[model samples]
Target chain A: MKQQQQAFALPPGAPSIDAMIAAENRRARKRLWTALAFMAPAIGFVAIFLLLPVFFNLYASLTQWAKFSGLNQFAGLANYQRLASNPKFYDATWNTLIWVGVSFVLPATIGLSLAMLVRGVKGEETFKSIFFLPRMFSATAVGVVWYYVYANEGIINSGLRAVGLGDLANRWLYESHLATPAMIVTHIWQQVGLMMVLLLIGLNALPSEPMEAAKVDGASRSQIFRHIVLPLLMPTLIMVTTVSVLAGFTSFDLVWVMGRDFPNRSTLTLSVNQYWESFRAGYWAYGSAIAVVLGVIAMSISWSLGALQHRLDKR
Target chain B: MQKKLSKLLAAVALGVTFTTAAASADPVTVFHDKPFYQSGWDGLTATAKKDGIDLNFSAYATDQFQAYIQSSLMSGDAPQAFTWWNGTKLKEIVDSGQLAPLDDLWAKKIASGEYDASSAAPFTVDGHIYGMPTGLNRWVVLYNKALFEKAGIAKAPATWEELIAAADKLKAAGTTPFNATIQDGWRGFVWFQELLLRTNPEAYAALNQGKLKYTDEPVQNVFKIWTDFYQKGYFTDATSQEEPLDFARGKAGMYLFGDWVIGLVEKGGVKAGTDFGAFIMPNVDPSLPNAVIVEGAPIVITKAGMENPDVVKFTDWYMSENAMNSWATDPGLYAGNLKAKTPNPIIAELAKIAADGKYTSVTRYWEASPSEIVLPAVEEFNRFMTNPSEEQAQKAMANIEAIASQYWASKQ
Candidate 1:
């Protein structure tokens, strides 16, 4: 009697299995169409604003187009060849490499240490906000303010004089050897705040169970952080490094504002070199070549990092 | 069927309305770089209104203006006319074949004796004028008379040796002998150009045209004297503040710059020709002809712009003394029109100097040289200023020559 009742319930008001499967498939297809409809605007925006310009730039790099002049002539690989032989190109590339290396090391160390210190401290929000304050300022404003701080009679020199180190008060931006480091210091000051906030959010999202278990099983704080917290934060760290490296490659405003007045233009990066060549020097094709080189470097680094992240994700 | 017919009628009505609106509102646009010329533009607008033509004037900051003009011209949407530099800089724009020849206007002006052939030379390329010269700026040394007196100098320096002596006296009197600023980067080439022009005017002209090498003797002499001045402390710190401010505060005895800096000096509370005065820089070699570097802004019309009769009318009105008088009086602009009355005394004085015919007028280096050559050369000059050693000077000259050679080779 129970089996008869179960069979009747199972079969009651039910169509054939094929019909039900077809109805579910139709619904799934409708859902997919709706999702695509919603995503159309974003897809269009990326294609128009991002992909089109990149393709156009690639085409421009292959031509001898000056600003305001029509691209009537095509000189395949000529601009890139010129860039390869140009000394300024080499100088800018080396400077960008330094910027990438320092941008990662300094910001990552400062941010990670600050995040760990402020994780559970009293007045945590206040401390976090203070560290995050500089990120709120636009890079241009930061550059202008730091320009004053690095001027010959600016804060740095005045402070040195006040402290009886007057002989050490040299023109910071004027010296080529010191100029890049000076600009890097300003870049780090502006970037550390953002890195800190990102790291803090990453730390908060970390699981408490593993850390607590490690602590309970006779593990030291450093042991738990090394064994559990850092491993968990690896993805965030990689993302932060990738972003910082790209920022280093494309840095312009601070370098332009601070180093424009300097005699040698000693602080010029690849981005600045591109601008000077294109707009100021009116070598649009050569500038495009520099741009393509910069883009290639950025993409290669980002792609390798992404692949690394994917490999780590699989583990 | 009724709804469809009504919709077709509505579409037709809207299209007709838009077409009529577009035809009635075609205004002539003029693009310029100087925001400080608001009063001058206001005067122009009033004249343009009376001609039954609607005028739309747009101004951008210097850098942005250049970029805007470039993009607009490239896109075939350039304005009726725009402000631009004369000489090789204008030649660059003319090379694009976007500019309209103003030979008709030039002939009219020349026949009327309003513009001398020499005045129109800078705007002319290949025997055709592509632009109208509206204003001129003469480069000279503006000095603080009080400081010169305090230093016990009897007269303005007339030779390189005398200038050095005056600089020594000014230094001994505890004043900066010359106010030079490398802060602007372009100023790095100012004194260098002046020295070269004074030493050998022919070589200077040839060098700007890429016909002569930068390592030539005249160029090397300019650097040698510049380095000597630096070593002797005859100039202010290379990294000092702006020249005008320092000169106005009585901190420096002499400043070499364009006549435009007189406005800045006056704004800084120093009276022209009393507390300060100017002189054409003395010739370094007495054997060479005296020359003054003349820079001017030209009004260029585009090919598309020439199609509008109103543009030609406006160009005629702009080149006339009546229109230029307002520019000269309001902004103290020195009109290139010979018939225009000068309002500023210093301008009148410089005009008199220009008219004397003793000193040859040459286009200023910044305007005369190609951008590809001048931009990097200025940077190299800045490097030389920061550390003026013989080795550095050689390297700077070589760098400039290398760039010049590349550009000239490409042209060939």
Candidate 2:
């Protein structure tokens, strides 16, 4: 009765302010629901394909499940324990660190240096394409090409012989010391392009005012870059480093193709070793253990790098 | 009119679907690693069809066959039958009790005198027949006859000295005497095995069983012999980029491989008997009867596949003399079936001699050695072959020995 009296008490031609507010709230809610409906498919896809599989992989890594076996024993930490004592596991992990270090440090630095040097050059795009050409090639192709280059009588030896350095024409992939380095060189060749491209974009987007101020204060190019450009490019550096690090951990094809038949088994990486252990050796659980460790190392590195990048970017 | 038309169309559609289903089910799935084992697989399938068999033959390349088999078997989606190496490979599944026992089938055939005695013993393990033996009983020197004749060497080499002489002659004739796929790390072991076969067969088996030391005198001799050949320029220093396909294509005078050489020769589009012929490696000692290294691949049936009643019928049909003969007589394959008539006279001679109790089939170390050890060791062997100094050879042997000892100790 009171609501009816208020409505009746309202004069004709007067706007209803309370009703307007309520209608606006209802429109906002409807828009929000519509936006959610629009995003539903993408959310569903991510949950199904990416997020769910990661959890499934985690579950798989903890079990003694094989393709045919119905048995999925909940083997908590047994895989980890076995990994601790496994000699090949230790070797692979050590090699993976070396690979990660090379992939993370060498590629990013070289690619960055090249990008910085070429960023101001004439025909920079052409040079960029040349450097990035290898990135387009499959890691297998990179391995094969490098394998030939390092072969006993291949181009390296052929060049060495032309200069009367035939004694230096030793086995590159087969030598105990040279195998990992050979694989590293191949990785660098395959990786440097992406780094250069990422950093170039960051460098191109750098604000000019700080660099201009540094120049006005009689700072040299290196000083200006050190003080202004690099400080600003920290986010990109972290990004390149993080990407390279993850790639190093996940690297399989180059190591597989280049170090496939090395005399010393020292070149075996976690990925390669895991593959052989599972498929060839039929030690499925143990191989899965190696993969889990690799995943952990990758995740830790990626997470820390992401956090670092975030902090620096915010600052 | 519309109703009648719809009824007729629906009837036709139903008929088409049922026939397609029937056609797909009509095929007997036979998985093979040797697609190029005959002239064309289509021709081979046609010939099999003539024998009243509808073989839906799926062939894999040499490299792809294992993973294909594993996926098919492990998924319980295998073709009714398939092929792989025997011993360790077969034992992987056989030991799991997944393989069907064919002992009864063998016994029935033997009682009827339908199967040869010598062929049965090698595939027999723990008195249970896991599979049928499907390879030539030995490794032989497959030499180009025309190349040999051009080099003025009359007949194949008969002894170690003669082999050296023939090799030297072939070298003198400007041909790579021995074909080695050095880049294909696994193929490098051919030299090792051949040397072992010449020097000591027992030691070879012991090495394969991980009983002999990798750096032992016999094993060292194997490497020493290989390096000596390399040092003498009998092999290439950097053929790691080359595969056996390249080796075959390059037209080397001789390729040391097993029974499937005949098919490879056919695939090469060359005359088998005239252009190339294979013979057992010459006896190192005249006092001892010449023995050939036997590598048998067994066709083992899986339990999951066996569960299918249709699959059982196919397996039963597989062991029939007709099916065996079809594979054996086609392109003259050295089949596992002892009773199957072989078109290859040379293999027939050896098969008969083995059956008559004159020749002994030395089991292949390749088939016996665990793959984990073998695969790595071969890579090392390939590496050493590239350098091939006495020190490198010894060190490689030591590495192999360590892995072997560790593996055997674990097995114990």
Give me the candidate number with maximum DockQ: 1
Off by over 4 Å in 2: A1-87, A117-125, A159-170, B1-26, B31-54, B57-79, B102-122, B132-137, B144-152, B168-177, B206-234, B243-254, B261-276, B304-358, B409-412
Query: For this target, which candidate reaches the highest lDDT against the unseen true structure?
Result: 1
> Which stretches in model 1 have alpha-carbon errors above 4 Å?
A1-38, A66-68, A119-123, A216-218, B1-23, B36-56, B61-64, B107-117, B329-332, B338-343
Model 2 Cα lDDT, one tens digit per residue, A185-297:
88888889889999999999998988888888899988987888888888888888988988888898888888867644568999998887776656666667777787788
Fnat, model 1, is 0.65
How much does each candidate deviate from the true structure in C-alpha RMSD? 5.7, 5.9
Single out the weakest 10-residue window by summed lDDT for candidate 1 chain B.
B326-335
- The docking category that best describes candidate 2 is acceptable
Query: TM-score of candidate 1 restricted to chain B?
Result: 0.88
Cα error, candidate 2, residue B359 (Å): 3.4
